[model samples]
Target: MKSPALLGRITAVFRQSGAMDKGKGKVTGVIALTLGGLAVLAVLAFHFPQYLTTPDLRKKYDVAILREIMLVGMVIAGGMALANLIRLRNRWLNGTALALILLAAALGGHRVPVDDFPDNTPYVGLDWFILDLLGSSMIFILIEKLFPLHRDQPVFRPGWQTDFTHFIVNHLLVGLALLIVNFAIHRLFGWMVWPPLQKWVGGLPFFAELFLVILVADLVQYWTHRAYHEIPFLWRFHAVHHSAEYMDWMAGSRLHLFELLTTRVSILGVLYVLGFNQTTTDIYIVIVGFQAVFNHANVRVPIIFAKAPLKWLIVTPDFHHWHHSSEREAIDRNYAAHFAFIDYIFGTAVKSERRFPGKYGVLGDYMPPGFVRQQLFPFTWKG
Candidate 1:
């Protein structure tokens, strides 16, 4: 069978009642496939660290812990597959999962030693991709389950494959993306870097520096984001992100490559020119990373005290969701990423009566479905 047909058939199992039903084995089979698949990729990264693993990420994480995680993933996937085989359920999915796990084992599994490799070797961010995916899925999925905006939203919702493909591509290309951003900053904005100003900015108190960096970065993003809505040419690339009809954690990953490069280059370029302290910049990265995923997440946080004050201070899922809505009032509104007050100050915040948006995605829904198609859409689309 074709790949799409096979994927459709497998995903259909997830739509059934009570996905955790042990007898059906559908959920377990999917889990096995996911874990098994990541294990295989992890093994490949181990074997070809020079070409696959990221240098920056390698220094930060413990090899022993990652190896342990790989081992546990293999064991869980294999055990689930075996159980499914015994129950005679989801044979295709479970069998394929088992095959992948065996393949990973044959390729030295987690035992593949990482000999000293040249750090300058051109590479993808495979290690970053694996770690971030594991971390985000574990944290965000649990959050969504606990405080779900749409209670019935499944783990494997429609358009997930497309969003996941986007996620994988974006993560794997992190090395290249960083390279581009660094190169652009140095070449284009080097003249803007005044040592005196940088020193002054760096000498600020830790909290002050943190607040300044976030505000500056968000200001750059705010204008860039607004342009993506107001400018027709830029909208072509931005539309790919807005095409995600569903509002979930993974929905935020459905971004076009052009948009990704331009946006990062723009925001990071400004930050570089400002020259915030490295420590503050690092913390800002962690904060921005967490909030980026959290805002787009299906989870909702209920603020009992100072609810109105907080909504005006920072962006929340409820606030950002309005920005993604296709409704007439929401179009080109709520463009701020970090601070809700930016929108309120600029007269762009949505003033709707209802709490959340009824629909998501582009107004006309002209964007295509697949990753490649969506990426090419900016150039090819007539309107």
Candidate 2:
């Protein structure tokens, strides 16, 4: 027979094991459910065209079905997150919140009549949904693991309130400003030079034209990005981006409206000069946008070949993180948007053996957060 002490110890071990087993079960269930919902979304996305074109379904089912699907998806994702939270892990809450917010936006905003719109873009369609949600999430997760601007910083650190405010303003307010700026520039330039430029460039093959367009746009971006660092006047607007103490998907979104306008206007000027066709421009926009976020992400890539020839061809997280580091050694290096070759050729590339940055955010330790203040900062703050 076991002694009383031994029996008590055995009971405690069993209890602890049971708790671990429960947590594991919850994790598995949450992952499975999330994946299952994604699968459903994919199916809906693919079949959306067929469903929309169907005379009976189109006549009977209104856009409300899309809203319903989105709402239900949000609830499912929230439940999965709640389940995971009950297991005592709060890390998954961000993913859950992302799902909820995106679904709500889609359901509410994607109600325009299909025929009346230029193209029949469906809200719940798999491509847009994946692009917005999964793509952004991947960028966020990658940035968190790679650059880790806030590796030593906790969530509620003194600067976090500012960081959070910057985040909300960038997403909610500044994004709209960028749209206005892009449209304005495009219209202004379109009136002056678009016709002649279009005739000249449209004669090239699609792939060739695309390559030229992207190259031109990236070249413009390279200079604009460099200017942001060198020119004190522009640095004020761009500082909102660099002020981040932590890097994530949303970190890339934390730019002031003025910064957004300046950057977009520069790129738009190039697009107008090049006269890229709509398809080429669309593809370029998608690739550039995704790469912009991905390069700044915290995702860790293996170091084996990442340091060799690969570093010369493409911008890796390892390379870009150095750009964000506060260390004197890393400042003012690796500014290329798409190709690492540009940075290498320009002598801005910095090679590292380590997988992640030692430190991140602005140099000199002086940074502020709030979106409104960041937008109006240079005018007001002495620093």
Candidate 3:
């Protein structure tokens, strides 16, 4: 399709949602909407388990806590949805909510079996996608509502569907991303590994090892991020991420696939070469994963995190919000991911008088409007 047609279709999708007018469909509405959406995904996963689930995560449904959480979410969300269905008399919310209640009833919430073992199979993080979506939505979305840095910003902002699409693709395709990154690392950096160094690093205490890996990984990322800004060719690809004038949890996932693969491949190569123990690597993954979303989320930090020792220790929403700013002063500043000290040590850090950015996006508003155009954008775009 031509750019005009593509934009029209994407625009039409944005127009069809329940709430797009800078308002969160109320809390009960939020619960109903979320559970309803998850119920649909659950049904899809049940029928198409292989494509939806990862090879490693689903293992016999042995954990009682996991089951309990699912059951509780269903009960609470379903109960409220039902009450509101009768009380509000709104067909759409009530009907959707009623469907979820039925889904919870039919399939047995959290009791559905998902145990499969494949000797060699492709991975798609269906479980991860479901858990992360529910978890992040409840946590960050709630926080943003409670303490919004930009009060006017709504849960369903303009261009939100685009960011949500990016989130789904990135998470659901985690297996593909991992397979490619792992292959590139083993093939390209096999010689870089030293058994002696690997063993020595492994010997360190878990916390110490974790600390070292975070520093090293962020150092690698810091340079990669800087290069994206300073190098014109790379800038086009990175611009897909920066194009979001809105900043929220979903915004962090709005990355160009090329940039995502290259950055991950590079970092994985470095991590593998260093031979960080498996436990150390796994723990760091969780930390970085949470921080990536948290720092981008539209949250207001507590007094402690906003000031003193903690502020210097890690990246805050305010700190990262500046990097996405179109402000001339923040052109390439605040590149550190896990640690704020990296920025302070280097001259690249920007300390501004304002609490947050007044606006966001690429400097001249250069990015195309929709995902289709944005995906093809970097290749055909002219400076």
The reply for model 2, stretches above 4 Å from the true place, is 1-72, 78-135, 138-168, 171-179, 183-197, 351-355
Give the range of the ten consecutive residues with the poorest summed lDDT in model 2. 12-21
TM-score of each: 0.93, 0.65, 0.88
- List candidate 3 stretches off by more than 4 Å: 1-27, 43-48, 59-64, 107-109, 114-116, 303-311
Provide the RMSD of all predictions against the true structure, rounded to 1 decimal. Answer: 2.8, 11.0, 4.7
Q: Residue 90 of model 3: what lDDT?
A: 42
Model 2 residue 203 distance off true place after TM-score fit, in angstroms: 2.7
**Model 2 over residues 1-383: C-alpha lDDT tens digits?**
34575446433421331112344434444443444455445445434543223222233444566555545555656666655556655434324444544554454323433433223332222343333555465456555645454464332234444544554444334334545776878776655675766798988899999888877887788889999999988887777788776655556667777777778888877687667787788789889877777666555656653766887877767777778877777777788877878888888877666656677888765655566667777788687
Name the candidate that leads on lDDT. 1
Please tell me which predicted candidate would have the highest TM-score against the true structure. Answer: 1
Worst 10 residues of 1 by lDDT: 13-22
Q: Itemize residue pairs with steric clashes in candidate 1.
A: none
lDDT of 1: 0.88
Compose the digit string of candidate 1's lDDT tens values, residues 70-161: 99999999999999998899888898889899999999999999898899999999988988898999899899999999887777777887
As a whole number from 0 to 100, the lDDT of residue 374 in candidate 2 is 71
